[model samples]
Target chain A: MIENELRPKVNEFEIQGTNFSDYQSPLFIAWQLNSICNLECLHCCEEAGEIMPNELNREEVMDFCQQIVDLNIPYVAISGGEPMMHPDFFKICEFFRSNGISLKVETNGLFINKEVAARFGKLGFRSVQISVDGASQDTFEKMRIKGNFKKVIEACKFLVEAGVNTEIVFVPTKFNIHETGKLIDMSYDMGIYGFYTGKIMQIGRAGQNWDILCPSAQEYEEFFKVLTEKEKQYAGKMKVYYYPYDVIEELKYRLEKPSASLLVIPNGKTKLIGPLPFVCGDLRKSKLSEIWNDYQKAWKKDEVISFTKQVIENPELLKEANKWREL
Target chain B: MEFQKHVKVRQEKFGAVVFETLREKIFVTNESGAQILSLLQAGKEPEAVTNELSSMYDGDPAVIKKDVDEVISTLQESGIIKN
Candidate 1:
């Protein structure tokens, strides 16, 4: 029998609308819990290691979570420099879980012990995605500077043993590209439920290391060929999801359709995703629903469209606009 | 006899989408299966579901009963229904 905890939250929204695409509410929130990270990885997108001064307080974070509950958002994906490092991480997770909001977490996995993994299982989180950048300890330590490869491996085991649905998130860099197949094998061996990997985005600390870390076009092609074969091999056994980065296609997609998910930073501000740096509204200053609607509408603005066009035509414009600038 | 608390059926034009919320599983049923599921969700007994389906469709009563029983058994196996 499928356990009660295995059921997904029935989205009334899916039934009410004739077409799923026509429905406008943000399907989920990518809430960055804190800026504090325990690792200083070579490709750290947020360069996250220390907490920002303006990080949201527990009360504010709880209020924002309550707002999400009120808005009836069924799912949330929490991440951070490392989300588990958040002072009120469990409290925030409990709020969402108790409200019947399904959750997925993106973490560095250094903090997950047996007790923590069991708690995650008991809370019934949808899945926990732990970053595992390399297949071997040497490459892992090289990419995830200051990260303990053995500790993370142990964490994955603990999560799996605790009955928590654990997954791996890999950012294919020069150091880890060759190990993609090996890592997937390792993840499957660990009893991971899914494997999510993608081309390392050239932003933040990664942008600084792009020349050295970014995989060559030929290397990416070779890696993807291996990935396709692995997908078939793991078809029924484990789920494999990857995002092959294409700058032009991604920019055009963003121009035509905004993300169906809101990106809430550690400071409670709803920022647009990378490339078109726009802050729609602050959750602390406005209702989440209002901010979400405004964000959707912001996609069609003349300035936003024009900026996106210029960037699409001349990708270098992205470098200047990538910072969190008010639109 | 009825859907478990976690099972939710959302009617679609073609049929219905049954969400087993706990395990996050989804079952897409055809029109007849949707009717059977809805009847079962409305607290109908297996025999009553067969009768209701028989009245609505042109299938033979005996075949309808067998189909209903099959659907019920499948739902039970999937943990969507409880006795």
Candidate 2:
């Protein structure tokens, strides 16, 4: 809605209504496969590099797949330092698909070659979003060290041709801000379905470099303005989402009730929100119904509300929010 | 004693819609199937369900019991229900 707040005269093109509806039993899930990442990007949040010692083993993950199905979370977003980096990535995908959950995988596109791209299309995944920090190799390499921009673009093309619904995530950082327009253009030209752009948060490795990488006030304002104009121009041809996402605002009273969205960390802990460290209950220790009650209760805590408020007000707080101490 | 993890039920105007949860690619049934599931979900035991259905429909006890037995066993085999 913040995107609509800019110009007062409701343009006919003014995107009206909302995609969110009443939350059902089990709606969405943010399921982390592992923190292990193949790339060490400068902006790596979660600072995920190598697999952690207590990371869930294969058997544990397989065991929990049934639990996740038991939870009935219909929409799952499989994420990680790099989710494709998980050895059992496809196995996990197969489990969720067999049980009835549609998945959206967030990956760095490094692992998706042409053959893999074709197989990925057949997996029943709803979408596969690859993070494209910059339009060109130089800017992309500097922001996400060791990235192959050409390879990612080629992967996207292959995936699109293979019938996999591909999308691009453009995180606006100092290095990539200038090229986002071209990136959007490329996504539209390439027939990519959606283009999502959001401000960088102060979390993970990005938190360490926030002072230098985070856009200045003028730069931030200018970026969204550019996005707004492009969104208007690309209106129907390519879907665009500019963030400072008021996604949850429309569900005000609903947030107070219970979140149908479940977050399961690699350690099998049920995290309240993406940032909130409050552990509801370990999924391994309790039934989802019992832990789910804890999830509902966690939402009412003062810390949770205040955290939500801060990020809603200053989306930049996202970078440091998960740190909790800063909150 | 519980519905399988993938088992899910959706209520409609006529009756309920039941299906295997993920991908919903497995079992899906309506009417009497949905009614039996709703009863089980509400914590009714197998024998109790047969008795209840017999009383509600005024069907022969032996006939209803036989049908319920077949349905319950099929549910068990499909892993949609457990003891």
Candidate 3:
């Protein structure tokens, strides 16, 4: 499950508390291991390339993971250029699982072979979201610039068959919005727990080709219309969920309180969700607990809050709100 | 009233976060609500709970009676309290 989705709407939400020990304990954290992904998606958010440097070495990452587990963080979503590319992927998974922290790995699905799937099943991950990108192999290949499309499909199937709670993530870009139904049907046929779809947030390569990559508001609405019908059709058989690009308006409500989750980049920078380039602190510079304690305060920082207010005012900012893009 | 099966409850200092896992619904309530929930979970009768809370908080009989009745009604409405 997306930690962002569990953020309470307002004070009225069922998730509330008082007399907290340490607000430093985040409900969840999404950490990017490194940005050296093999497949370069057209709308790559991290602008991930083949070359990755300045990443936390395995020892540093292990130390940080230990700190996170000690802080009693409930969930962690390990993503990357492709998290599976991390040299210590299995070690990291084992460490987190042993610490009683539920893990959810998000990857391009290229790395999950039968062996990887068996290890994941052994460790008992809460879930794993392997990006499908498109409904058909041709369309998937088109969006995901390089990769043997069959391998990714094989990887997903292997994970599911191995008893891993595998989730397929389909990113709806302009090129494949029409094939969303196929994507849902594909999930229904496979019969895993569910699948996730979300609108492409224009950034990096996506921002450069926003006109071609990003779907228009009308197009997304039409897509969701089809999705809603599909959801009804597969209500009992399969669960299909999508994050609409338009729902960032809810961020305004979210800003009233501390965020339920936080993101950590490969370089250990505490990052904001979506395309925003706001970094609160480098985890290497301070403890994860310290950074989390300051997370609510981080949102109040001038430029970030201004950008957020601007987002509240102009919701379209969400579609393409990268700091580098503005420059 | 007994809580439905899978109505998982966790008590906190201030109150509790009750999760009805089957429905995937969570309810956040204050300390008083937590007391009522604990009492209910222990299989206390409504009248007995009312008497206990009324004595504990030094509340008026009629006011406590009405208040307890309303709280039970609300919990019942939300399917938190089961027959």
Candidate 4:
């Protein structure tokens, strides 16, 4: 979460003739469609399990989509405790697609059967990233508790068969670092278009289990070496993307030029990413443009900068930041 | 003719990218194609587009008209513009 965790792939964006820097309104929106989920993942970023009482209703969601259309923002990446589980998931997808906004989905892939896959393909999603954290079923189930690895694999196969641009997302940690190569091979065999992996962030459920789940520096170094080899091996076959977090770089970027992206949680509030638990404004009460303006200014505030520094110095503060905060 | 309400045309450094929302498709065009799209987006007719191009470039009027007609046809076929 310390980085622009939901930044769309540069190559993919370029292919669509989208240059994020050129946009007036924030072009990329990382939307948490809901707070309810089917699985209790070990590193659940939102600590998402139960439904939030104030999650956006159908009308509100439609209004939000209208605001997006008004702003002419081109892309949105939908995630959640599980976005597919949201009752209006398909409707939301259809709204965005019909409005000419490109969309990408981040899901656990459990809900995607053949019929759902056909619907997804029909929706023409730019890409669908499915999380299959480990190379083996035991390792995967260890991270995504109660998740069936075979079902996820089957889901990927179905999505590919449906002609959807499918990719795999892996978050590496101490427990699953050894399976990196195997996971890549598995993804390639499934006809995945891309393989996106990142280092586990020190926030959310992951922050709670940092000691047990976070990989050692040496482990990351080893993993990157393997990743480098895999990139070369998979060149021209499957795109490989890895985002290693750098807190200092992220802090600078936030201070100077924050991403032209906003994180809209399930409760219709826009929250700052990482250990800064600051809410810019409530989307329910404000327009997207107003919230976006407040967001840009929030990064420049001394309170935000100092608090971010404090969090970096004392990682324990992240636990407090992970929860919803009024301001 | 006008670009569809759901269709958005964005000018990029290389050319222009046209988004057809109903179909969930993106189309890229070269410099001249981008000019043509911009004109169409501004509600220019095919004849007006040809006239504008005739004034902008040193090409023959007939050839420019032919090119405009071809570009307009492509845009219509792609559902980016409509009468």
Candidate 5:
């Protein structure tokens, strides 16, 4: 059904009255194929690398994909645990592509090899975002924990060579902030399309060791200045973006707000916002209009206001916001 | 009069409800409850809130007063609505 047909009609009593055009629905849907990943990063939000069995099965995922296609979402981002870890990762990609939904896979770049990269390219995937937290093995391995930096680099090469749009996301912590430039240069050399440098948000397991994971405002400013300067130097070659709410203003002009995006968790909970526990609505039961209406109401009631305000006030928080774009 | 901490009314698409995420609980209330919440946000006293609800809805002042008091008391016990 067309979104307009399903759009809820808001009347005067609506908390946010009718003139809510500025609010856009999610254009890209991020489906967490599985929460299990090969690498356990220090600041992993989805807590990937930890297997959560009893998640959505293949049939359920297919149904979810059909719903997404019905909704006419332009893009679907397959994330994890590690999407590759799912038994039907290839089938999932094929299903999404066959249904005319552009797929973007978020991975650690370990399982993605030359063959897999070529297959994804052949299947017409839109982009592949791989987290390369460090430029060197020492720092990269530290953040990714179980990830093989060499394998990640190899995956990058394969994806680039296969003509896949590759985006390298660097989650800067005290240990890897210094390697930001090197990471960018390395990613650019690998012929990647963009580099997203982000600060480690003190959420999830990363919150425990926040003293080391979270960067100070001053540190972020220095890192951002250096990175953006490099980004300018490499302008035509690759686009670079930064994260954390603090640096949004600096990168605001370059950000493109897509038309509609939605994130469906394994449990059938579809979220318009970030990967928070509060879902907009469950697609298994609620209609798209119901979800959109709920999201609008929540957004109006300041549920998302604090997070948006935090991003506005602190550019560093933009990093998380940027991550959502890829998701 | 004993007052509790701040109370916030989060109006979602399903309906206007009060919830505390930190506590991970939802407090469901009706339109009158939402009206009472609006008045409380303005720092209105129980009597004023009763008066406002009485005026807004087709209810008696005494009944409104008792209902508002009950809602406020429950909200207070739940640590959402405060004085």
Candidate 6:
């Protein structure tokens, strides 16, 4: 028998004079391999293209992957500016696969071709998330800005056909909120394993264009209700995971409690929360444990619970809750 | 957050080096550049530093002024330099 293949390493380190723990059990690591992307999406959080030649090089990424393997992290998501745009992307995947790490990749779906999808399937990646903001070419192209919507759909088809555990990530916006249900149906028709929705955060390009980017809380909740009903109708075939705000009380039973997750930027700077301001520390200089502990302290349980409750009860509070990272 | 236009030292695996944060981009510099940055941090204007740098390094004042101006513009764009 494979003796409990997943085991987390418990190590401590310090960051900016604060102590923390690293890679606690049940936690996931999000490694941002590069801040360079093939297509510059309209609402990119990283403002990716601005920073070229990100600090963490190929060797550094391999070493970091090895450390996660040593720690036996249950899962790790390779994200980007556009992870596929990384010169050593395949090598990184091969390293993770050899280490028995459950891997997930978040991509724009523009760069992924049939050959790449097949390779990912061969590597046994647990999941691949492709973002499709709109249902039709006109809507999708407007937001995605570069690639054709048909190309993205083609990529999705490739992943689904390749027997990959595929997810369609739809970002609800004023432009695409109305098409949420259609997008889900499209995802289902394409043989997608699941669909997940993300609420746009007001940061980076989105922040700059808040007038057009930020959707009202009511609009989001309405869309959520529609999607939830659709999910019920198509229950056995495909799974749908809503964003934090859209999740209802009844769905909470199915919702997994938020676990500790770490996001390391391309420069090796690590942050406990999702993309936002302030990094805990640079992983190369500080031990992972130290950064984790300091992050835990920052993430006050009482505060998070209270804020979460408020958001569920009053959708208007979603904006405030999304900024949990900054707090 | 707001950052001031100045040279900050970042220690990398290679060695301790200075980078001028112009907006968010980190631009590395040599000893002479560092000295000029220090002078700027000390509230010296480009014009004021021209004579001093010319006497110290035996370089042309016009060249020094041109270089300082270019760096300052980049720093301003990067949010490292404020009026």
Which runs of model 4 end up more than 4 angstroms from their true locations?
A: A1-22, A325-327, B1-83
Per-residue lDDT of A296 in model 4 = 72
Encode model 6's per-residue lDDT on A114-183: one tens digit a residue: 9988988798777888989999998888788776799889999998888888988988788888899998
User: Whose DockQ is greatest here?
Assistant: 1
Lowest lDDT sum, 10 consecutive residues, model 5 chain A, at: A7-16
Range of the 10 consecutive residues with the lowest summed lDDT in candidate 4 chain A: A1-10
**Tens-place lDDT digits, model 5, residues A1-327:** 112322122112221112232323334466777777667788886655666656766677777777666655545678877888789888878887787665778888888888988997788666788988888999988877877989899998999889887888888888888888888888878898888866665445575566778777788888989887987989777888765453343223212221234567666666544423345677667766566566556544454555655655664453453133211
Poorest 10 consecutive residues by lDDT, candidate 1 chain A = A1-10
> Across residues A1-327, which tens digit of lDDT does each residue of candidate 2 receive?
002221111111111121112222345668877888878888776777888657778888887777667655656788987999888999999888777676789999999999999988878567789988888899998988878999999989988988887889988888889887888999988888789877675667887787778887788788888899889989978878876643234224335544456777777777766544456767667776676666766677787777667666765666653443311
Q: Candidate 3, residue A245: CA error in Å? A: 3.9
TM-scores of all candidate predictions against the true structure: 0.79, 0.70, 0.76, 0.79, 0.65, 0.65
Error of 5 at A229 (Å): 1.0
> lDDT scores for all predictions?
0.77, 0.70, 0.71, 0.79, 0.64, 0.64
Candidate 1's displacement at residue A260, Å, is 2.0
- Positional deviation of residue A183's Cα in model 3 after best superposition, in angstroms: 1.4
**Candidate order (DockQ):** 1, 3, 4, 2, 5, 6
RMSD of 5: 18.2
Local error of candidate 1 at A89, Å? 0.4
DockQ versus reference, model 3 = 0.11
Regions of candidate 5 where Cα sits further than 4 Å from its true position: A1-25, A244-260, A302-327, B1-83
Q: Output the chain A TM-score of model 6.
A: 0.79
Instruction: Give the CA lDDT, 0 to 100, for residue A301 in model 5.
Output: 47
Global fold similarity of model 3 (TM-score)? 0.76
Angstrom error at residue B10, model 3:
8.5
* Candidate 2, position A233, lDDT: 88
To one decimal place, how large is model 5's interface RMSD in Å? 15.4
